[model samples]
Target chain A: MKDQKIVIIDYDAGNIQSVKYALERLGITPIVSKEEEVIRNADKVIFPGVGEAAWAMNSLRKNGLDLLIPQLTQPVLGICLGMQLMCESSEESNTKGLGIFPLEVKRFTNERKVPHMGWNQLEKLNGALFKGVVAMEFAYFVHSYYVPVSEDTLASCNYILDFSASLQKNNFYACQFHPEKSGAVGVQILKNFINL
Target chain B: MLSKRIIPCLDVKDGRTVKGVNFVDLRDAGDAVELAAYYAEQGADELVFLDITATHEKRKTLVELVQKVAKELNIPFTVGGGISTPEDVGVLLNAGADKVSINSSAVRNPNLISELASRFGSQCVVVAVDARFAAGKWEVYLNGGRLATGIDLFDWILEAERLGAGEILFTSMNHDGTKNGFANETLAKLSEMVNIPIIASGGAGNREHFADTFIEGKADAALAASVFHFKEIEIPSLKNYLKSKNIPVRI
Candidate 1:
């Protein structure tokens, strides 16, 4: 996987540099681009985001990526907002998602806090994403909305309630947390994704 | 459960760490990137660098430092001090900073908060407020607690949140250098009033102080300067103590 061609979607959702740096530290220099052909031909695809859904979706559609992403057959990993956009729909702006997964993204009820921001323990670990990661391992998460747990859920975390911490269906995998900033456990997760 | 964050703040001047750190193993303790990576390995959940660069050209030095640190460090970090406009914030974020904390600039012009939030989402905008108790109320201060403002702390924070501040970094001027403990009473009040996470800064002497702030004050995170710099309270031991006290923290 070290020699694999990795491409990160240059989706204008803010903070794509962190993903590039994270991968660089692992000895892989991923190509950051918005060109459809370059992304479609990569060995691995990294979808990274950090802002509003409606605005990001507009940016995706502008580059004609809204039609190209769901068709990606290679191993694809979506992070934070990237993960949310891969769902059926989101409540952030009532935006329709790519529908790779049937789960619907909903907002937190304010029973505790709006954005469940901080390090939270991962539970019920499953699939290749949790390959070397243990149960109750901490991962950095900063999101206001989440997808409900389903058969595709690889792991779950409790914040206000049980939510899908990570999801996988075929070659598509998504995580609500930021693995790029989650320390060693995060580094291992990235390694697992590349090795997949 | 969300783990309580333990952040070590570095006072940087001209893109270098100002306060003396007691790490004998460090070749250059003043190097901001080195100190940031050291803390990240010490189990610090996050790091906040307060740059006190006075000149305009020297601020670019901070961006370069942030880029180097971001390349090497794995955990999240926030950069602050003298950030006035969105252009300033955009440069820092583009350099790989997770968030930017604005205090005096945000106070002078409230719309800056809304503008930054709208431009970069509320998650990257942190409103840092410095205050001290005076005249039967907590009064907001400017210029590192040197000048006093007629504004009340509670009123200003609520307004900042209304204007779209993601998190509040409240530093109690009275307890900052005292080395006694955090202002738990006021912090608890802040948690009760706001729906967002509150970061308690200043007045941290020992490991117990961190525990007290998280339990009694109900803070989402506790930040300290001298204690961590001088090795008075090592982060690894502090996190162990916190765990023993039943406080959730990432080990």
Candidate 2:
């Protein structure tokens, strides 16, 4: 299991180093690559992103990763902007996403705050990614746009409104928070993803 | 809802923890990595490491220290001091710092803020302002509070936000190490001035001080050094006190 190949999709999105470090701590050496063949053949693929939607999408298209992501049969975990990119589209700069989840990402319009940055509780866990995870467990989040609660949502968190904190559909899984920066509970989530 | 954050600041000099008043008369506290791990266990929302003497050689040591702490701790960590260019920020972030704070550089060349924000998302950039109440107004200070820039605090922070600073770390030079309380009056005003989260630093003496900073100061997070370094206030007890006062904490 330790020798299994895990690939982290690197389309020039931020936070890749932290994800690499997190996997290293878990005793797994993840390959950070932009090659389609490497990502396609890996045991599991981690799509981690942090940056503007348009720019990230542009990079993905440039590297031809936008096409390669949806074709992977292995378990794929998207974090933050990576999760948003999995949706149909985002309100941020009117950018279109990868359309894997068939959900639209919208910006928080309420008067609370823009970024909604901090620790928030994840309730109603309902997928393998959250196995051994208790309800109402806190996870670190930092994002302005969020995917609304939908049938595909595996977990939900409330900031200005209830939003999809984690989504699951078929072999694809995504979390709208930084598990790498989230601490102990986050480590468990990553471990579950590894096992899956 | 996001809980109010309690951040313990560690000032590092020559790879060792140091505590000082008004940014002078530094004294050794302990090893930086050891203290950082202790803070993570104590439920500190986050930890800040400032390389006080960010000399050419010390900068390399700081990067190694950041890697050490990042490997051991599970919580978020921020690194600052003498970060001037995007490459410098890249080095620290690549070393595993969750965020990088820019002080003198941002003030010297305001464009540095946008440069960093563009390369690494705005969430990765923290603009730290060391301000002092001088001549009937708050003025921004640079070089570890040794020089005054004649820049208005409110005006500069507004520009920082416009230029893409994710958060503002406002440290009141006058209230630092006083153990009396925070500069709530100014902090509250600053919080109102910007939509971004403001981290109030300096002058945290007791548990109530944390409450006052959160409630009165309206700061999203409160940062302190001496109080935590001297064990004058324990992180767990301080968080418990804040929780009792109806202030949400991580616990």
Candidate 3:
């Protein structure tokens, strides 16, 4: 397992360092790269991000990384804005995403909260991410926009409404929460992603 | 639903955790990294490391300590004190701090808040307001509560929030070190005025103080120093108390 290569796609988004540190804590030195070949040849890839949707999308498009991302055959994991970028489109800046999942990222409304920041419980867990993790385990989240629960939703959390906490479709997996910031349970999720 | 947060704040000076009463009478508490890992294991939702070191050389040492602690724990950690610029914030964030807190510098240059938020995102920026009631008004203080700014407490918090501060750490100087309880009335008012999360800091002597801060003060989180530093209140037991009071706390 130590010999397996893990690449963290550097789209110049936020929280990339924390994700790298989290992986390092698990004894895997992940390569932070934007180069096409390095990302393409990795055993596993983590597409982690934080920040405004439009700015991030523009950066990805500028580097032509947007075109390269969808073509990766390896297991890819997206976090927060990275997950939103994987969708069909987002209300934030009205930008289009990778369309890996037929989902829409919308700004949270209905007067509940804007960012929906803090730790919240996950329910209806499915897929390899929650293989040994229990139902209703808490994970740290900080985001204003969220991907609504859809067919690709693997885990759901209710903030203003039931939203996708974790999403999965084929080899691509994503989480709206910052699992790197979450405690021990988060380590398990990262471990599962590595194993997958 | 988001659970209420219990944050254990460690005052780090010269690479060691220090306990100071009302920002005076400093005494060594323990090692920062060890104390932080203990708090994380004790059910502390998050940790705040206030680098009280005044010199540039010691500040660098604190940054090194942050890297060491970040490697030892998994919970979110916030670093504050002596962080004046976006580059300073960048240093700590790169050192593995989840957030950087600014107090005096943000007051001196209000634009710093927006600059940091734009560069690192608002989620990584925390604006701490150390306030004290004087002459029938709550006024802001700076330089570790040695000087008072004429800015109104509520007004400054609202302004900081508008300027892209993700959260506010409101410490009531009048209630600090008293152990009577948090300034619930003032905290509740501040909570009503701001849309972002407010962390109630300063006076937290027992478990009930935590509950009062959450239920009455309406704060999103409670931060304390002496109580936890002296072991008067264990984080796990305090969390259990909060849970029993029907307050949602991570355990």
Candidate 4:
């Protein structure tokens, strides 16, 4: 349980170093790699991204990660755009995702702010990803697109409306928020992922 | 519901915290990273590091400081002060700064805003505008509020949003040093005119000032420096006070 081989997929996306820093805070120096074998051999894989959808997908495809991510069987965690890319499709750039989770991402309507940037609490928490997390704990979020509440929603947050804050299906877990930048609540989620 | 953010502003000079912080637990009080970690532990929603160094080595020092802050702190932080080009923003963001705030640079070359938004998503671009009420109207100021650009506050914010600025940080020079309250009237007007989030800065002396900003000013976030750094208002207690006012804050 202590020596889990964790690797964070690095595909030239924004803020990948912050993910490495977050894992280092957990006392695990995660390997940042785009190599197929290095990612395949890891006990836990973390896929993180912060950029436009179609552009990010292009980077993933360039590194052959678009095809390899869906085949992984490890306890994988995806953050922000990484999670969106795992879905069936995204309204952003009208791009198709990797289809790991049967969901879709859409742009936030003008009813509220576009980036939904700030701290928001998680509701209806479930699964090991939320272990030891208090009810309605706040986590940092910064994004314009969101995954609507659906079948795989492990946790939900309300902004313009109820959206999927986190999704879980089999070993694949994804969050629309930046767990690395979410302070303690985020740290707990990462620890839970490592422990699982 | 998305809670209103409480951000603390830290002034950095020569890779160190310039404004004196009052946290007793810190071993080295001058270190920017230590102070940033302290603020995070105390429940600060987010942090803004304003670099005050004005030398050629400023970038290298600021980048190292940003790297340290990201590695040590878990909460999101924005790096400001003297950011002008896409290269500057790219270096800071790559070093782990969540967002970069541009001021005079954007005013000088308006195209920079569109360039930054296209290169690194609008979510990470924050345009900080310093303004004051003069001649019966709000005029934008530049170079730390030393020079007035004669740019209308309302018009500038509208232009910034259209150019894809995710958030607007407005500091009322009139209310800044006064510490009486925020520029609620102007803030409310700016918030209404723009679709992006408005972060109200200047004149935060008490907890009620924060609540007022959220209510009357209609700001999405309130930022303060001396109040949090000088320890006049602790983040946890301030958050509790805001929560009591039914201002929807994360405690």
Candidate 5:
């Protein structure tokens, strides 16, 4: 078969360029689109975001993508806030999410800084993203809120607390870290997603 | 584990890769794309391209060069120099840069940092601060270390972080091109003070210098021009030396 058409949903939440760049590096042409047809026709979807939770969700709601995303029958990959929005609800905007996974997005306990930035290790690679990656591989992150690990948790990271780094449920896959900026390991993860 | 990065800083002038000693005495390096691919295969973690001559006549050529590099290399890369507007950053990023570093322009218009950070998020915005000791304190320099901005080094780093800079690339003017070692003391101070990752530049002479930067300065990454270009310290060898010291590197 021809390579699966990867579509990166763009709500202007930031980090789309890096996600697109990363996918391109993997020899996959990912379309950054808000158009329904493009996303519905894509074999896989990557939703990448970097911003306040509520505002991002609100933007998704405004474009009615909040409804369009969960309906994705093909494999869907969400990055950072995109992953957060895949959960039940968020403290970010007091907004409800797609509820694809049994998880909740909450703000980090104030003990640590708001944005837990920089490189951190990811463990428990139980899904496609870690197909061949070594355990404890470091990935770059920059976010204030995180999704608590649930039954579908695929990967997790630690800062103030342990949280889901990557999640998978049936056709949905998401990561809280920016794999696009995580160097070679990140590219490998993207390659895995393409192969899936 | 992540693979170690070997980055070649391409200083572009008139659309050609240029090298200089201590910020002067310019000489031509190889083609940007060819050189970037060479470093990538040599185990470079990432690549940085600084448009030293980002002037009016030579503007489009810089973007064209970045496009070429993006087409050839597979690793992460950052582009800096003469980025005055968010549109400029967006253009370079869209053309194929993973991150965009801003220096003099950020100092002149601090709002640019917050604006870009808000629109693109902090992770993509890198604040490159060039510092030189003057009048008993480190002062930030602009225009490729040609003009003094009178901003305190530590204070500027703090401000940049608060304003949403994802990372700080601290280059020591006194140590640049000297082949001595990084200014560990200054890096240690900034590393302790700032929360964002710091890339230590200037004065990286040998393998020990790499260890010292991480062990003492606590920098997340170390960047050097001459040591890497002149073949004095190979990237993999340097990573091996650091690994021997029990420093965590992607090898």
Candidate 6:
């Protein structure tokens, strides 16, 4: 079979380079753009971001790509803020997400620390991203908001709470952790996404 | 649980990696990209590139080298040496560096840490300080350990954290390249003084030293050079040993 083309939705999000660089390592030169036709024509899509969820969603809506995203039939992946934005709503910056997954993104309570940085174990798996990986394998995470664990959750990680590490519904897959920074386990996850 | 990280420090001079003992006796090692890739595959959580050659004529060349490494390596890469202002942070970030380590400049202008952190976020700013056991205390050093800044190491570390540094890369000049062990007492003290992750550098000769740095020194990460470069301790084996010692590490 011919290699599948993955399109990374780029609306000036900060993590574009890291995602693109990771994809490139897997022999996939992801086309980073907001062009409707390119995204619609691609075999797969990757929504990557690192910033305030509201601002990022606004950027996506301003470019008219936010509306086009839910319509994609191909497997769509979201990272960090991308994952949070795929939910029903976000407490971070009072953002409304795509609602692909029946989940809510909420800010970390002050009882612990904000911006739960560093590596954490990802338990529970129900998505292609965890295919062929051991349970509770460590993944690099750097986020302050999390999607509360729900029936749609594909994996769970705990920092301040046991929340969804990744969520999947239909052809959509999203991870709160940064696969680009998670080393080999992250590389395998990206590879699984490409295969999917 | 995440594994404690083992990082290999590369001193780049004029776009090439060079190693020395006690910050002198500089000798050629290998290309930065090749070594970084090797270390990454060997299970290094990250790699730190210190532009030991940040002299006037070598600054631009080192930046170019960083871009090259950033392009080829998949692991998180940090660059340090002569970063002074927020603009320098921008230049390195734009060149694809994952993090920028600030030392002398941070001590000179404490606000530079906040400026860089505010602009790029704390995760991007790593405050580094080289210290030596002087006058019954650790003193911060600058200019590759040639000059002393007279800043108390503990006070400077706390100040960096307050200024929004995400991580602190503390190197002990007295133990650097000595291959005896880390300044465990000093590291333990500093580790207690801050909440941000601390990367212990200098004086790593074997696998046990890495565990000691993490366990006894209470460092979040351990960094070395000669041992890794000379094949004294491979990254994977050291991590396995650390794992056996009940220290969390990515294997």
lDDT values, one for every candidate: 0.93, 0.89, 0.88, 0.91, 0.80, 0.82
Candidate 5 residue lDDT tens string, B213-240: 8888877777777776677777878778
Clashing pairs in 1: none
Clashes of each: 0, 0, 0, 0, 7, 5
Clashing pairs in 2: none
The regions of model 5 sitting more than 4 angstroms off are A1-3, A21-27, A91-96, A106-120, A138-144, A159-161, A181-184, B1-8, B20-29
Candidate 2 chain B weakest lDDT stretch, 10 residues: B20-29
Report chain A TM-scores, every model.
Answer: 0.99, 0.98, 0.98, 0.98, 0.95, 0.96
Q: On a 0 to 100 scale, what is the lDDT of residue B91 in model 2?
A: 86
What tens-digit string does per-residue lDDT give for candidate 2 at B1-251? Answer: 67888898988887777764232222323678777877788888889998987568768888888888887777888999989999999888888888999999999999999998888888888999999997799999999999999999999999999999989999999999798999999999998888888999989989999999999999999999878777788999998998899998876
Which residue pairs overlap in candidate 4's backbone?
Answer: none
Evaluate model 3 with DockQ and give the value: 0.62
Give candidate 3 regions above 4 Å deviation.
B20-29
- Which candidate should be chosen as best, given lDDT against the real structure? 1
Evaluated on CA atoms against the true complex, candidate 4 attains a DockQ of 0.86
Native-to-model Cα distance after best TM-score fit, residue A171 in candidate 5, in Å:
1.1
Give the residue spans of candidate 2 off by over 4 A.
Answer: B20-29
DockQ of 2: 0.61
Q: Look at candidate 1 and tell me the lDDT of residue A98.
A: 88
Evaluated against the true structure, the overall lDDT of model 3 is 0.88
Q: Candidate 4 residues B214-237, lDDT tens each?
A: 999999999999888778998899
Please, what are the lDDT tens digits per residue for candidate 2 over residues A1-196? 6787999999887878789888888999999999988988999999999889999999999999999898889999999999999999999899999999998899887477567877888988997888888888778888889999999999999988999999999999999988888888899999999998
Q: List the residue pairs that clash in candidate 6.
A: B3-B248, B3-B249, B3-B250, B4-B248, B4-B249
Kept native contacts, fraction for each prediction? 0.80, 0.46, 0.49, 0.90, 0.11, 0.24
Q: List residue ranges in candidate 6 displaced over 4 A.
A: A1-3, A52-58, A88-99, A106-115, B20-29, B55-60
What DockQ do you compute for every candidate structure? 0.86, 0.61, 0.62, 0.86, 0.27, 0.42
Residue pairs with clashing backbones, model 3: none
Question: Between 2 and 3, whose TM-score is larger?
Answer: 3
